[model samples]
Target: MTTMTAPAQRFREFRMPDVGEGLTEAEILKWYVAVGDTVTDGQVICEVETAKAAVELPIPYDGVVSEIRFGEGTTVDVGTPIIVVDAGGDGAAGSADSGGSAGSAGVAASEPPAVQTPAPEAPPAEPKRQAVLVGYGVAPSATTRRPRKQAAPDVPAPDVPTADVPTAAVPAQAAELNGHDRAAAVDRPLAKPPVRKLAKELGIDLATVVPTGPNGVVTREDIRAAAAPPAALPPVTAAPEPLAATAGARETRIPIKGVRKATAQAMVTSAFTAPHVTEFVTFDITRTMKLVQELKEDRAFTGVRVGPLLLVAKALLVALKRHPEANAAWDEAAQEIVHKSYVNLGIAAATPRGLIVPNIKDAHDKTLPELAAALGELVATARDGKTSPAAMQGGTVTITNVGVFGVDTGTPILNPGESAILAFGAIKLQPWVHKGKVKPRQVTTLALSFDHRLVDGELGSRVLADVAAILEQPKRLLTWG
Candidate 1:
């Protein structure tokens, strides 16, 4: 008698990658493909936003999509499987015959199929090296699974029963009180890992909360609701309103994650850690403004954006050349000051995601036209939300043009790990003393905030003075530069 064998199933899982360096989690922005869709190698499957930037992830292999483990807007930990693909193969069919002869084949078909038994256990041993993208490669041994809690063993009932309770009905009574079976009460709650973490943080017992999700699962909203106080209670001493209130609310709460959350944390750290000393200078910038107009019409600046900000950036670079000590970072851990030879000039851009500071690497080496091109590209990329994380790292100094918003002058905070930040104010035709006369001339304010620990008052003053002097007389850019 001949026994027929089924085709073996081959599935490959793709985990959420650490797109940025050492990022632990990322939120799934959107999914480009769904289940039952055929996918090829290096096809973009989804977009995810980390703390740094939003990056698109591509599938590394060719297969038919079998499952999407996480939906959009779900933040997943690194190395956790997010999708599964069916890589068609029949290798297990051959392994089925290796174990048995024709005589035992009849017994195998009648009993639980022995070949397919180990299929569930085979995934742990499979190498994970092939499950990586081109640039972001996860280590083979980096995949970690949270340990599951074991169910408590059953205990014997007491011989004597109380008047209120009976030994036979103990399990049912416990199940009714907890809204679940006695066995399930001992097991872990039916919630996702993130929800469980939130419940733990909010000090809410998952068992006590009612499950409103499908299949009796507890959701994030359920945890929030459980943590909120009951509305029936009297308002004793005007308590603050809840963050997650009922519908038709007076306030809207945006979840703090991704770029906004990261920026908040970094700003807080910078504010308390750095000793900021801001110095301001209001001067007649008519010469520099005229130079901007001249550069716009210049053939050398063809196809490039020539503006006041470009000259301001160039002036700052020139100032750094004179005062190199200002372009340094305080290394707290090492207890030393790192004086950088090259300047990675950071330009603060406000994108839809949040405020990001992507710097031009080796800005001191670039010429005037090249600096303008870089600034234009940086602003355009930031507006389109395509700035990379690497472009934001290693900034020696920063410039924030608050002038674009038509704001006069405000002391700006230094970017984290940098020594100084310059705020360029709005350039307007104000009455100013130019050439020994009070005349309506183009005037602007410049505020320079520096870390006092590394840059003393003398050095900060000199750097600010140099930038103002260059803008006041554009000829100094050729002379001093």
Candidate 2:
């Protein structure tokens, strides 16, 4: 009797998705799984640092991992297959389970229940795949790198008269290679593309440099060391002296790829694209400060964050409602102003990665305590670098509390698509006239920067004035909101 063999398991590849936004590439920061590990659908497989932020990528299918196409620290382009999994759809495992049940039924009459049956003829198949949710299935494309160009063939030089040849030339070549072609051919060391370019610019030959990198690859330091003074070279005559060890800077260059790169590009685009006009106002926030303290004692704010920032955010939303034009975005391609009805209030939080402006969704709809809770969660998530891309998108307005750093205030740049940004300055006790009497009051400065194309000076001034009024009065929020 012939036993049937099971069909082969099918593998599915997972390609890198854009995460969010149209970011083209990301560097694999860490891998959470290895070959042969069982992974479920929606499990985080790896963390990648993109031009925007560090994001954790979730595998969309359930199966045993088969391969990791790229190692950690490798930058992979969007749509590239980074992992493979065995998603067995064919009834390989089911067939083995049927055979095992049959074998168990035949042996139960004579043997003990604990006795083991004979193993199946084939290996267990991988788990079946589930529906992917985060990103699409693996893209069909080749994963090979482009081939390097071939060096041109060397041409044999025409014979020269031995009588006229210099003796020094012939001896130098023999000495350099020890009269062996193999020694000459093995002189060139391996290096990454960037290191090779650096070596070329510094006039250092890789052939002479020693390798210090993994697998005998030459590094930037190796090139610099090869170019350094030989310890025996005599001092040079009065031209610009070579940069000595003391003069040479020991610099550490961090790649500008992730958050820093994204922030820089966004700031540059916003600064140049929008004609920014900043208006500052110094006001007494003593009433706002007193309200924050009173709210902290109230049961409504129990275990919830109550602070000046929470009040500032609420005031901004109220001001936006008053001056709707200031809370709009410019659609350059459509040549129209997009006025948003809802507020996605963004609060700028400084993180290890960089500045990320994550917003509270529908913040205008939330009560003061609810807004405080949302703000607290947003700040905590941002600090932990757990803020999702969706949370950072579609901000109608932003508040950057520069006061935390003791900064007076700054001409804050608008977020790429948003029309306005409010910079809240440090609050300090200063002598001020209140009801015609000079008394010490809590004073702070507010700088509002807005796009002139969407919000005119009058509209911007109204929004700023409204926010200042609410802070100074503390009771205007009830009337305005």
Best by TM-score: 1
lDDT of 1 by residue, 199-251 (tens): 99999999898878654668777898788787823342233356355567675
Residue-level lDDT tens digits of model 2 in 1-481: 3244433335777888877666667889999999999999889999988776678888877789988889998887666578988877434456546756455444443554323232323323333333333455343322222111111124221222222222222322322333356244334466655578889999988888867764466876688677768762332211232333336645433556677788999999999999999999999999999999999999999998889999999999889888776778899899999988899999999999898899999998999889999999999888888788889998988999999999999999999999899999999999999999999999999999999999899999999999999999989998878
Note the residue pairs that clash in candidate 1. Answer: none
State model 2's lDDT. Answer: 0.77
lDDT of each: 0.79, 0.77
Cα deviation in Å at residue 215, candidate 2? 19
Model 2's TM-score against the true structure:
0.69
RMSD, model 1, all Cα superposed? 9.0
Error of 2 at 372 (Å): 0.7
Off by over 4 Å in 2: 1-9, 87-91, 95-250
Task: Give me the runs in candidate 1 sitting further than 4 Å from their true place.
Answer: 1-9, 90-115, 119-248
